[model samples]
Target chain A: MKMLINVPESVVPDALRGMAAAHPELAVDPDSRLVVRGDAPVAGKVALVSGGGSGHEPLHGGFVGRGMLDAACPGEIFTSPVPDQMARAAAAVDSGEGVLFVVKNYTGDVLNFDMAAELAEDEGLRVAKVLVQDDVAVTDSTFTAGRRGTGATLFVEKIAGALAEEGAPLERVEAVARQVSEASRSFGAALSPCTTPAKGSPTFDLPAGELELGIGIHGEPGRERRPMMTSGEIADFAVDAVLEDLRPDAPVLALVNGMGATPLIELYGFCAEVHRVLAERRVPVARTLVGNYVTSLDMAGASVTLCQADEELLRLWDAPVATPGLRWGL
Target chain B: MKMLINVPESVVPDALRGMAAAHPELAVDPDSRLVVRGDAPVAGKVALVSGGGSGHEPLHGGFVGRGMLDAACPGEIFTSPVPDQMARAAAAVDSGEGVLFVVKNYTGDVLNFDMAAELAEDEGLRVAKVLVQDDVAVTDSTFTAGRRGTGATLFVEKIAGALAEEGAPLERVEAVARQVSEASRSFGAALSPCTTPAKGSPTFDLPAGELELGIGIHGEPGRERRPMMTSGEIADFAVDAVLEDLRPDAPVLALVNGMGATPLIELYGFCAEVHRVLAERRVPVARTLVGNYVTSLDMAGASVTLCQADEELLRLWDAPVATPGLRWGL
Candidate 1:
């Protein structure tokens, strides 16, 4: 559980300073703990904002940029950002065209962002929300509220950001974001448990030669724990679950994302296996991506996401997207 | 070093099968260890091919698609794919126009890819090469042969792939690829070493509370090892080095790439820091990206790359790209 830092309390503040220092285009509000692009109100464009816990690097924060989110509020490590921070971000990026909040389907994230949206509304701003619930790992909603948003969050950010950049109305952007969430499904398997910074211990007991399949992004236990299997077998289990949830004979965007510690080689192997599995089923893959898009903190595992895409969805997917987390087309 | 696998030797083969299955549109030649899109060798278009060791996922392999490379050869984990594999890939995707090889500046990668190019030429195929030596971490040619290509490879892949996809002449594509490689630069910092599957142990020792700055992609020792610093400092070191090398005043593309184990939250913070740093220098950053693009096994570290983009480069970056690793535009 060793980490590199002068003090645990300064991790967030010091990190923000450095972030602002490195990305001049991004404006960092130390007091509010928000990072935003220098041009607060993007002129006549609709603004997109997203934020969540801090453990998942590049998720809500890295996605703040042109063709994506206008700002991001990063909470302390593994903790949700307060409503005030989100409020500040909303105020900073809101344009007359309105603002969209891209929230992950987490209790803390949803509640906090909801409160912030209300606060912004009180301040005479228009805000809409798109909740991302793409993770198919958990079926029990009683304890967790809903399925966790994992790799599919990226699809929402990329597409919604693109839509917003193209000056789509808030309603259209929110609808498209929701569509991405619906069309996309994700599942993860972790080989090792992550040790939270505050807890300073393993989140759960995963024996030396075992894996937890269908795990949550927050390091929670999964649907099953079995003897470690081959990458091919793991791919079969993960991909089949996602494909089963999504209908057959549809074009889909595939993502083989690393949980955290898995090597690119391992992830590539996983993607390779996923490709083979889909080919056998005669699935039409419209697009494919393999990388660490959404990640756990040094957790040795990976996730697979399949987003069904039609011509319009594909066009939106291909549209220019510029974010700190996902950037393309310059 | 506890990996989830039925057998170490079967990792690559099983992964390949899964990839071919999942991305049926992307063709995989098991015999040659080559992966190409189903619609490769487009009529009257020059073919672009690239590859190297397997650890840096999505580099030469994940980039094979419509707007990027036509084919990719996956070598053994962290080892350059042999010349025969490269030859096979060249043959599979080469049209009557010609082929361009985008090679990272690793000695093994350069040697292997160069040999493959010679073999392809001997087979009566016109071939050109663009060697990437953008990493500024190592003294250009002091400790090693030259700076190791790390994150900048992505820019080369995207821009070069775009040119090839647009049916640009082989000479034009080769020139564009070379321009990208020269204009881009990268540097990395690591908290821990990545373990090679064959080795079964970390390649280097990173003391519990220390970090290695300016490390190469192959787990090579970095320029400096200091007590672990905050994420901001890490970002500063990497961003400062890249900006110093590029001195870009016009809009540029910024990439904050995780080596492997670092999470997205940290990368996001790092991106924010990078944005701040560039702004201070009055550099106009056109776009930003934060993720795990070029990685080193499961190393806990990150690298940053900066690419100067002009109109032509931007067009290529925006063009449709489809591959198992990166897919965009229809």
Candidate 2:
């Protein structure tokens, strides 16, 4: 419950100013609330755009740059970005080709991004969107919406952005992005609840010595709760579920993501267990990444994402990408 | 302090397995404790390598991919990786084009990596290194070893990796990486100490209302301890110090990195204040990135990194690079 801040309201804006001062390659459109790469309208390439709640830093906005997203809209802490922000982001990053929107499977995000896309389309801009529903913890389609997109969204942006930079058309980019979504699967578990800056206390109650499996990124309840297990056991259940859902025969890409609050040491512990489980199952892991790629707001949990990699996927994966959040090969 | 684990000793190995399962593009040589890109020995490009304590996930290890580092050596949690691991990483990724070792300014990391480079040289391998010393908060390099490189190391790896991927010789990569190290500056503030899984307690003491500024990534005490301030005021002080150190007139690349446990909302708040301060100084804010790039265990802190960039640095920033931790335009 300890924090260093002047006031709760100033957290977001203060961070934005710090970012603008620190990174010169990215421009902050204060009025629009968008963080964009300087030369965003990159000629003929299809621009990729995404945004959501603000508590998860670098998820959407930080990934805006050369090889990845052209622009990202940061919403209020844990709240979806309004349609105006998304609409402007889509428009600013749009080049001659078109723009692609990568949306997580959350009601607020879906509704808002969908509205923004419609507005962009009305503006004579071509915008296509691929909804990411990679989370496997939820299964009720009648009462609630579909599974919430968790970790796989990172892979979607990564591959889709690479293809966009390669001058792939919007349709092709959307198709591959969707394929990644279809092939990817993710599940998460939480050990503690996180407090929203505005709220100042935890959103939920998670007693010590317990873990919530199948949790959502928003601090929502998971499918089950049990006594806390070692990182090895947690990795077993999470990676097993993802592997079962992905069912990959060839080598696969692994995205072991921390859902905020989990230490890097523990994440490595999770990764170690996952590798052992996969090895035991004879699953060929083509590559591996362990970090807080997609995170919640200090929600002491982690998620696992498995993407079945093909030659095309690997090529796209290897393609050059530059964004405020991720930059390499220039 | 609360944590979930089985045996503390197995944390790092378990995490590595999980990372391998989650990211298939990275291949883990468990025996050697080296994580290399699946396509390592990248045919004809100089290999780039980095590493340090295990707590900073996605740093030295997570950044192994196409456009970034060719290999990353992960040490035990908060402990530097041994020399053999770095030697193995250098050997596995070197394509006869030499290797550039990018090490942060930590005594353990520098020592182990230096020893490893010597070992590689003893075996007739071409190797060069750049020690990152960007943190301006910890003064008094005259008495102790210089400032501890915390967040700015990412900028060094990223830009230098781009050059190496573009066929820059080992010397050039090392030189440019050093230039980034010298030009960049970073400082951090921690609200709470991180609990090591093994220790099951915090690495340091922090009161409920105060913060430690200029802390290292591995729980090292900062230069000052002060009552917490608004995100804006904190951002101002941090920015002013960095501006004094960097004194950049051109556009800069900004990295507002969360140590861990700090939400994106908090980061944005920091960013907003930073932007305001830079505007006041008439510093043309060029590129801005806000996120949790490098992190401590589960400490609630954030670091600001500024890198002066010109046309060439910007071009290199845009170049295609692939690695597990950072994947972009390929």
Candidate 3:
């Protein structure tokens, strides 16, 4: 598979070990498949936990720190973590205030987090779950029932985590997470397919001169394939798809995210077009983050996520955050 | 080219435009092709300026901010910025203390920055130049004389910029820059070749299951190509290449950088092996950064840089940095 891994079997644990080595501030438990804030379980503070697959790096795991996710349970690549992992993460991070699980709206993530929430509740910990279904690409997909959560997961985690860091109640944190989720939409376009370590081949067939629109992070069947388009054209289509679904009345915090292998130079070029399209539609951008935050492993593509932001959400977003995936204003 | 760019001709300017839009904190001059700190000409602070080809992103431009670079001049892809751009950037950021030109050791960059220094001197500005040539991959490469500059540009900019931020004179900044450069060594290995937009094809043919070692950032001929190796095996070779030259006794600040297209998951896995190798060799790491900081556009590979860190260098490295590419303690 031409990947820089020892083997397909140990990819997840090896990466977790790497994460542990790089960021000693985080308590990385390779055995539990958990990444938790070093000083998690802050007394009486709401704890935020999220996870899904391993490939979308810096998403759930990279977001764990001072003002983002309290803990993350990463699964094997493109697979969901079991309920045991999530339950253990909840137990590790939950304080008297309770735990808020930020579940992406994939079927496996939803089901597993739901079971974990019950497990946490059974253990006498207050648990609340918020599902992020911001991907407007599909209502049902290869591994999802409703909309597949994508970029807005970042928005939800950052804003909600900000509130939680302020010692907000678990219910408030969950509500804020839901608010951000409902207020955001994402669309992705892939120029190449991602090849998982286990699979060792591209999950899908995307010819060199063609591209897929509305593609899922895991290379799931997208809206359609077409001849490759220019950056501006891709921006036009992706932003239109998001804007049509978002129809925002307020300004947005724009995320022009790279899907794994897309370079920053290209991300910047694509982000300029995204800004141009948003400007043409008279949508005010409250803030913008451009990088590989939510990514598919080594997929050459980009995704645009827009979250309608109010003053409170903007304040929450601008709040200090220190995490491997996203960090700012700290 | 199946790139997220409008056209090869406009890629640099468009990406600059994107940089401006995304980071309002930086004064990005698209026409002049300069990215300067938003608050440039900071009284008597030594102005740090660096730039080279546009492909290695977040290198010079993305490092412009409060604690790193004062200005950067991005050239066309894999091409050095003209003397005029560097001269103008010096004019924009110099506040009488002096200007320090941070030049990579590529032939074009060294020549252009040398000319730029002369121009700045003629404009009644004192300018000192520091050339980074810390790559141990080859004594000389296709575009370089002596050692090729690679990951240590980041170290030179950062440690030197931290000193510059404290209003150090040009000479001291230049001295520290040279120190960091001399103390650091880097080695890169590539799984796949990078394709420039203008080329629209892989720069070189790297057959499947084969990889190139000691590759220049522009896919210049490396030491050799061999059958693919595991991340640990690659780390063993790359770290040996670096440590053989550096032989650091003090704790080192390690930068495990991705060559554009390598995913974070792999980078982390690779990082774990880097730490293991360093530990085995009894080399202590003062700090570590893992990501695509200095990149060759969309190359599926990575580079390892180790800078022998003394107290002063570690303090400077720990100093606040708020650039787009690297940020902490701000």
Pick by TM-score: which candidate is best?
3
Count of clashes, each model: 47, 94, 0
| lDDT digits (tens) for residues A258-306 of candidate 3 | 9999989999999999999999999999899999999999999999999
Ranking 2 against 3 by DockQ, winner: 3
DockQ agreement of candidate 3 with the native complex: 0.80
Q: For residue A206, what is the lDDT in candidate 2?
A: 84
| lDDT (tens digit, per residue) of candidate 2 on A1-330 | 765556777666655655565556788765567888789788989999898877776687777777678888888777889998898888887886888999988888899998998999999999899999998888643213888887888889999989988888999999999999888999999988878778989888888778889888778777889988877788789888787677897788888777777776577667777777888888887767676668887788888888998989977876666655555563
Ranking by DockQ: 3, 2, 1
Tens digits of lDDT, candidate 1, B1-330 = 677444677666655665665556788765568888788778888888888777776566667777877888888777788898888888888888998888877777788888998999999999999988888888653224887877878898888877777778989988999988998999888888888778889888888878899998888877899988876677677888887788875688888787777765456556666776777778777766656778887787788888988877877776776655565553
DockQ numbers for every candidate? 0.31, 0.44, 0.80
Per-model TM-score versus the true fold: 0.80, 0.80, 0.99
Docking class of 1: acceptable
Error of 2 at B256 (Å): 3.1
B254-319 per-residue lDDT for model 3 (tens digits): 999999999999999999999999999999998899999889998999999999999999999989
Model 3 misplaced regions, further than 4 Å: none
TM-score of chain A of each: 0.95, 0.96, 0.99
Model 3 pairs in collision:
none
Candidates sorted by TM-score, best first:
3, 2, 1
